[model samples]
Target: MKTFGIMTLNFESEALYIDGIAALSQSCGMECFHFLPSSINPLTQQVQGRRYSAIEQRWFDDEFPIPVLIYDRCFYGDDEHSKQCIPIVSWLKSRNDITFLGFGLPNKLELYGTLTTSRLAPYLPHSQSIKDCSEVVSALTKQKKIIIKPINGSQGYGIYYLKKNDKTIHVKTEKNKKIISRIFPNETKLCQWLQPLINFRPYLLQPYLELSNAASKPFDIRILLQKDEQGVWVERGKGIRIGNTGGILSNLSAGGSVIDFSTWSSSLPPAGKEYICSELNFIITNLPYILEREISPLFEIGIDIGVAKNGALWILDVNSKPGRKVVLQTDPDLKETLFLAPLLYGKYLSQSENKERKSNYEKTLYH
Candidate 1:
């Protein structure tokens, strides 16, 4: 039988997500293995990880060859552990004998930088890497209301909204599920407050879009895109994520609620609704393919799109390794599709490889 591997940060952290994929792998006539990047032996190409034992219906400690195709879900961070293992994953990716389900996107700044050159530039906000304090001050001066986010952040962590009111800068963030706000007297103070954070990891700046709904809660349309059984891109689901009133982020991790996309779209004006919906369709359909051309092939991506008061749409962020909270909350029916996506795409990749190998062999015989 065929096998698929889930390459995650750790086997324990992603157990739930892995279990869903494991169950589907069995139903699809395939095996599923779970491992961390650190567990692979580069020399032997053998992974010291747990394989899902079908007889026991649970993961058991075992050794196996690396899955032909890896679902790279290893989330990297600025921590030393992440730094240590990046090379391992990098080495794995460089191997021609194995294939990855998705090669993954670069950091936010790089991602936006690439998309800025693509046809999707119109839908992207002006973003730049924060080199130092001056860049943040200059952007804040020009765009009084701006956002400072860790370029490598996920789930709305380490994101701040800064609004300048004369000499004062108001910064807002959510921590431990609580919204916290602070005031800095001037540029000097604001920069001082952000010094440690900037020193910790690279950050980016963007003009904060007015993404709140009429109720004054920040919101955005969260959509999940994935390759289907036939290896074609398809929209799995979409949901409206509404944050607390006057909050900076609408990410569920930042204290947000979910609503059906149609429910929110139906409330918009006829023309506005039509335009927003049209642009969304265009963005989702074109973004994955364009990013692939710029970066690498992707099995799935979660796109966070924001619409301003004037009905202008912006691609706020692009995530290669996306979470399924929004979709699971909004469309429970899609649970099965989300689980089966990686397995099906893995099969697609293997079949393609086998065909290529056969064609090459036939050519050799003829030659």
Candidate 2:
């Protein structure tokens, strides 16, 4: 039987999800192991990890050869340990003998720049890097309301909504599950407060579109698309994330709630409903092709799309290592299939006679 490995940053992280995949791997006639990139031996090409036995319901002490296929779940950070493991993981990704499920996507700004040049440009908000404080003043003067987000941030952290009044700048953000508000007397004050943040990390600025409902809750459509065993892209599920009333973000991590996509879409008027369905269908059909051609062969992606009050659709974000909460909450019946996807894809990669392994880990975009 082929050995499938689940690699992560910490060994103890995602305990339940890890075991669920391991249990299903045994049922699918594959041996499952869990390990870290630091566990790999550079000289011997061996891995020191724990193998799972479904019958025993526990990980047993064992050593094994390098896995035939890897399901990478590593979320890189800026710590020394995380920094140390990045090169190790990159080296593993560079090997032609080992295959990964998804090689991950580039940072937010890179993704946005790529999509802006594609057919989706009409749906993209005008964005630019925060190179000068004057740029923010210029964008605010033109658009009235603008948003600033870290180029590499996730889970809605460090996102600020800035609305330009005649002489004051109003800022709102979610911090520690609470709404944080501040008002700057003028552009000079706003720039003073923002200069430190800009120096802290790189940020991308976009004109903020109003996406709240009648109840004042912000929302966006979260869609999950995954490749099946036959190497075809399939929509697993999509749902609506309604955030806190008057909040700036709709991320579940930022205290947002889920609503079934069908129910939400059905509540719309005929024209609104028609617009959403048509545009979403167009995106779902073409997005996978876009990523594969421009990025890499991905096993799954989570797409965040926001619809404006005027019925305009905008692609907010794209993630290669997307969460399952949106799909699992809306469609509980898809639970079994969701857990089975990685293993089935791994098996397909192992059984195929063609050696189509990846050496490039989507690194060219950084330049």
Candidate 3:
């Protein structure tokens, strides 16, 4: 039987999801193992991890060779452990005998740079890396409103909305399902607050479009795309994520709720509905192919798209290690299909005699 591994920074990071994948592995003719990058012994290349026994329907502590196929679900932060695990995972990706389900994507700035050159450029919000606090001041002075987010951020964290008032700056963000607002009496005050943030990490700035609904709640369309058993790109699902009223994020982590896509589309006027359907079709059709061609091979993608008040569509963000909450919440009937995806895809890769390892993990983006 083929060996499949599920890797994460922490053993409990995605316990339920990992278990679901393991439960289906046996039927796919594969033995499942779960481990951390730090568990691999340098001298032996053997991993100290947990193995799932299909016969007993349970996991057991075991020591075994590194699985031939790996599913990387590591989410990195600025901590010491993350710094250590990064290089280890990179080393694993560099090996010729191993195969990763997906190599992930690059950072937001790198992603924007590549997509801007593609045919989907018009759908992208103009983005620029924040070099200094003065740039933020200048952008606010000209655009009146703007958004700044960490280049490597995920889960709607480290995103702030800034609006220039007559003589002050209004900064707003949603955290833990609550709205946090602050006012800066002057640009100097704003700069003082921004200096330390930008100094700590890289950020990208974009003109803030009015993406709120009639009720003043921010929302976006989240679509999940993945490769199937035949190595073909297929959209698993899409849904509408609505944020708290007056907030700037529609991410579930930021206390947003999801609704069915069909319900939302049915409420739109005929013309508007037709236009949105056409635009979504164009994006879903082109985005995956474009990223794979420009960066690396990917097993899945979670795309966030925003609709401006004037009806323009903007791609807000893209995630390689996407969560299943939105899709599952939108359609509970897909629970079984979602759990079986990884195993089926892994089986296909293992059985394909001509398959080659083409992942460049070091450069691939992860968020």
Candidate 4:
């Protein structure tokens, strides 16, 4: 049987999702293994990880040669372990003998730049990298309201909404399901807080869109796109993510609720419904191909789309390594399909003639 490996930074990171994939691996004519990048023995090239035993339906302690195919689910942070494992993963990607289901996307700023030149450019909001707090203050002063987010941020962390008032500035963010707000007496105070933040990491600024609903709860449409057994892009599912009232994010991690897409769209008037459907169809159809052409191949993507009160659509964010919560919550029947996607895609790659061909594109795209 062919070998399929699920690589993650932590063994317990996606325990349930990993378990589902491993449980279905044998039926797909593959053996499953789970491991951390740090577990690889640099000298011998063998990995100390767990192998799934189909007969027993359990994982056992085992060491083996690196798997032929890898499903990377590593989420990096500013930590010592993340810094160490990054280079090791990069080394693995450099090898022609191994196949990864997909090469991840670049950071937010790079992604914005690439998409800005594509046909879908109209859907993207104007974005600029922040060099200092002065840029942010200038934007807020000019735009009146804007969003500042980490260039490498995920899960709605490190995103803030800034609004400029005559003598004061307001900053708001959602953390641990709570709305945290602070009133800066002046731009100098806000700059004091923003200087350390911009120094710590890169950030991007864009004008804030009013993405809230009638009740003042922020919401966005979340869609999951993936490659099938034949390596064709397909929409797995989509749903509505509704955040807390007065919140800036609709990410589940920020105390958001999920609703079926049909339920929400049904309430819209015919004209508005048709317009939204058309715009969404255009974005969904073109985004994947654009990313692959300008960056690298990808197995799956999670997109967050914002809707303004004036009926404008905005591409709020795109994630190469998306979570399954929104889709599963909206449609529980897709559980099996989601679990088998990696196995099937990996199998297709292993059997294809171009299995070992690596993209000559720069490898900096992986985050």
Candidate 5:
């Protein structure tokens, strides 16, 4: 029987759902092996706990006796324990015998200075990254309002929206009190007010998206999209995250609540529903293509879309490893879809191996 292995930081420790995927693979007639980070030997570069059987010449756990297929799921490089696992992962990828299911080395996320702005323009709120506060003040002067966000930030942190009036500019945080509410009679004062942020990190200047309800903060939708066995794009699930009571960002990590989109959409008028749906579809369809062209070797994408008060859609952000919490919480049935991913990956590997074998046999016969 065919065998697949999951290469993760803690094989049996975290992401408990992965066990379900292994069970599914077994049901589909493939053996599953889990090679956790802790199992690796520091000196010999051999995995512990499981020994290779002489008869099979493959690593086995008694229950699973087949060659290994590594499912790279460990989040390394961030913490100390996970950081140590990076060497093991690197070693496995270098070896020709093991098959790494997902994108391998050289395709990892790189910190490019221009990548965030260039790749995320389509989805980002009306924003521009600028170093000069004068340019930001000028833009705000013309537009009358703008929102500023750090170029490289996660969750709902470091966001400021400024409202400009005749003589002064008012700047407010999502939840905090108004930082700048005085009328800046001079452009010099306006530039001085934004100097700290401009000097700290690159910031994006965005036009404030006026949400539908004046009382309700602006909200965005998080859609999880994945490729199935046939490599077809499928919507795993979607959830509407409402921002905190007085916050601008609707990120769950920032105290946002996940609400049912269908129910929320139904409460809106027919025209609003049509507008929202069309914009969402456009983002979902166009986003994957954009990532494929710009970011090579990305198999799946999680798109964050924002709907403006005028019924326009904008791509806010794209995540490489989108969290499964919202998906699993919103639609428990989607657990099956996640379970099926490894199985399909296994089948694809089997087909690839068979093709290689057939080619080798033909070469032998010809010689």
Candidate 6:
């Protein structure tokens, strides 16, 4: 069996998500080891329940052998104390023998730009990160109604939608709303109110798709994609997430309810359904290829798509490490399979090695 090494943050016992992935890896014939940075002592060079020293500031499991594959699952920056093992991760990738999965070494800005320029662009909502408030206001005015999301936000957080009228712009949040009047008929006061929010973080301005239910809650579709052993892209599952009434975002973390895409699609008109399917297909097929060619290395992607009142489909966002909640909810049976594909691929390679060994043994006997 191939050994797989995973470098991740300290996941609490309550974090069933991480546990699920670990279990799946083990089932796929990969001996998985999770290195939690928080539990490590810099002075002792040891983690809880283990005795090991850092060689040139890298932690290695003294009991287990060197890993055949290393999955870089750290979400935070490389410099954070919680991510101090990043240098160790880099060292692993430096070795020619170990295969590194997820985030082939790149800076943050370069990685973002790579994804934004790739096939993933279509799945991502139209966004412009501008420091100039004037340019952002102009873009918002053209759209009439638009949403501003933090470029690095997750789980429907830090999303604001602004609806503009003649002289007033109404800013709606997930919890409340604020109305601001245009101070100067020419200058956009709305931008001034938004400037503070933009801060150091990049903000994305996207046209708000009027996706609403009878109760007026906006909803969106979440599609999970994964690669099988043969490197075929497979749609693991799809779900419709309905946001809280009057909410600007639809995320489970934001109190959204997940529903089957079939149920939601059936509720829509035939034309709307056709439009959505066509747009989704375009996003899934063309977008991945585009991202692979244009962006840095990326093997998997999750797409959030919304259908407007006018029956037009819009790409909401593209997530590199999209949650697997929907996959488990929709098809629990495939959860292990989908999540362990990479590990399973490693296992298959190991099996091939065994076959080669047996063939050599048989040849020796025949001779």
Question: Global lDDT of each model?
Answer: 0.82, 0.85, 0.91, 0.91, 0.61, 0.60
TM-score of each: 0.93, 0.94, 0.98, 0.98, 0.66, 0.73
Model 5 steric clash total: 4
Tell me the TM-score of model 5. 0.66
TM-score attained by model 1? 0.93
Q: How accurate is candidate 5 locally (lDDT)?
A: 0.61
Tens-place lDDT digits, model 6, residues 1-367? 5666655555442245444555666456665655554544546644442212223322334544455665556554324663465555444444556554443323223334556756555444565665767766787568878877765566666677767668766776663332222333434566666677777567677777788877898788899876556555778889888887777767877777788888778987897788788788877877656544544334356778787776667666666566777656766787566557657555544444322111111111000
For each predicted model, how many residue pairs clash, with residues at least 3 apart or on different chains?
0, 0, 2, 0, 4, 4
**lDDT at 70 for candidate 2?**
87
Residue-wise C-alpha lDDT for candidate 4, range 151-182, written one tens digit per residue? 99999989999999888999999999999999
Model 6: worst 10 consecutive residues (lDDT sum): 358-367
Q: Model 4 segments beyond 4 Å from truth?
A: 360-367
How close to the true structure is residue 36 of candidate 4, measured as C-alpha lDDT? 93
List model 3 lDDT by residue over 1-367, tens digit each.
9999999998889898998999999889999999989999999989999999988888899999999999999999999988888889888888879988888888999999999999999999999999899999999999999999999999999999999989999999988889999999999999999999999999999999899999999999999998899989999999999999999999888899999999999999999999999999999999999988888878889999999989999999999999999999988888778788888888888888856647456877365
- Quality of model 4 by C-alpha lDDT: 0.91
Candidate 2, residue 43: lDDT:
86
Q: Please report, as a residue range, the 10-residue window in candidate 2 with the lowest summed lDDT.
A: 358-367
> Candidate 2, TM-score vs. the true structure?
0.94
RMSD per candidate (Å) reads 5.6, 2.1, 1.0, 1.2, 8.9, 9.8
Q: Where is model 3 more than 4 Å wrong at Cα?
A: 354-359
Clashing pairs in 2: none
